[model samples]
Target: MDRIISLFSSSALLLFILVVQNTSSVYGNAEGDALYALKKQLKDPNNVLQSWDPTLVNPCTWYHVTCNNYNSVTRVELGNAGLSGQLVSQLGQLSNLQYLEMYGNNITGIIPNAIGNLTNLVSLDLYLNRLHGRIPTALGNLQKLRYLRLNNNILTGTIPFSLTTITTLQVLDVSSNRLRGYVPRNGSFAFFTPRSFANNPNLEFPPDAPVAPAPAPLSS
Candidate 1:
């Protein structure tokens, strides 16, 4: 009887330990998965993320990662790093992300429209990268945006009219690309100078483009 009781006690202790470990592991993996998707999208040249080993445990201990009080990602700063890769749509899963600073890299790819799901995003700095593609119209959904810099890219397309809906935008830079078309007449464009749209071989700033003729009235 004594031997059976001892065996049962040991088994119960082991199970308790496993339950706690599994709970912690589950939360850690959730955070890791979010970042794993981001790393997979971008091409990293310097192997900066080599140490982001989820197997080793919490991402809060990794470099260039910042988490909030609830252990959710808040800021992702990879500035000046020799990284390259596409911005994957999986990044949208980081709904609590407030700032994503990825400056000075060879990264190339279209900005994923799924990024619009980051409703809490405040600053998105993708400047000084080799990224090419039309800025996603979904970015206009970021109502809290304060600074947007997509300059010095090979992007070719008209700026989406949806961007005008962002009433909070203050600094908008889309210069040095292949963009063309009359700049939108609202939001920051209402009084922006030629500098904001400079160096585009095909663009015609507002007032430069001739007005379209009004539609003729139809017979009753």
Candidate 2:
């Protein structure tokens, strides 16, 4: 009876260990699936993201993927990888993400509004792509953003007023796009040069095209 009881206890302990292991594996796989879904949304030019296999079980181990000590994804640096395709809204699922770089790709399509969900983002570099559409107003919600580069894309429309709300912004370059309108005269926009605002025909300038000052109050 002693032998049987001991064996049963050992088996139960082993089962518990297996359950914990499976749970960790599941967590990793779920995150991996989210990435895989993103991969499907993008068009991988030159097959660069071919190695982004969800079956790897842990995206943290994948190239360009950085993880926190807790093994959760913290950054994704796929810059100059030649990826293409529209950014899907699911990218917002990376709750802890701080940096995302996908520059120098042929990716086309509008910047997803869901990117505004990455409130913890510190740097976002999507330059030199074929992406079109207006910059999402939701982006102004990224309070932690420091470096934002969206140059050399096909983006159109006026800059969102919410963008001026990113007071934490240190480096912003929306140059070389189709953007047009009155550039905000505060924050980073105050210092931007004609070069930064070049290439767009409809963009109004300061001093040269000063906004007609608000009509002065009528004499009392």
Candidate 3:
């Protein structure tokens, strides 16, 4: 009778442990699935994304993907990997993502508004791509954004005034795009120079703004 009771207790403990493990696995798999969705849309000719296996419980082990202590994705470093194709909206599902580095690729298509959901984002580097369409005003939601580099794309339309509200912005390079309209010269824009809007022939500086003289030559 004693032996039977001990066996039953052991079995119950084992079942409890399995249940906990499975619950955590399910949460991790959701993020993994979101990344896998992006993989399907991209053309990875060099097999850079070969390690992105959906069967894995978490994407932390995947190449070019970084995760925190709790296994939540924090950074995705896949710049210049020769990837092309449209970005999927599911990328916004990475709730904990902080750094999204996908610059210097042949990626085309408009910037997805879903990206605005990444409120924790610190840097959004999509420069040197073939992306077009107006800059989404929804990006104003990223209060923590410090570096927003969307230059060298085929983007059009006026720069969203809402972008000037991000006080934490330290570096903004929207140069070389097809952006139009008057550049905001107030708030965070006050710190930027004409060079930030250079090469965008349609964009104009404030009409009454004073012209800055060329810097004096440095003493030899």
What lDDT would each prediction earn against the true structure? 0.81, 0.82, 0.92
Q: Per-residue lDDT for 88-176 in model 2, tens only?
A: 78778777789989888888888889899989999989999988999999999898998888999988999887877788887888888
Pairs in clash, predicted candidate 2: 43-84
Backbone clashes, each candidate: 3, 1, 0
Tens-digit lDDT string for candidate 1 (58-144):
577778989887667778899889888777777787778889888778778888898888888888888888778788899988988
The C-alpha stretches of model 1 lying farther than 4 A from their native spots are 1-28, 56-58, 208-220
**TM of each candidate vs. truth:** 0.78, 0.79, 0.88
Q: Please estimate how well model 1 matches the true structure, expressed as its whole-model Cα lDDT.
A: 0.81
Report the number of the highest-lDDT candidate.
Answer: 3
| Comparison by lDDT, 1 against 2, better one | 2
RMSD of each: 9.7, 8.0, 3.2
Per-residue lDDT for 15-74 in model 3, tens only? 999998888788789889999999999999999999999999899999999999989899
Query: Which whole-number lDDT from 0 to 100 does residue 24 have in model 1?
Result: 71
Candidates 1 and 2, the one with greater TM-score = 2
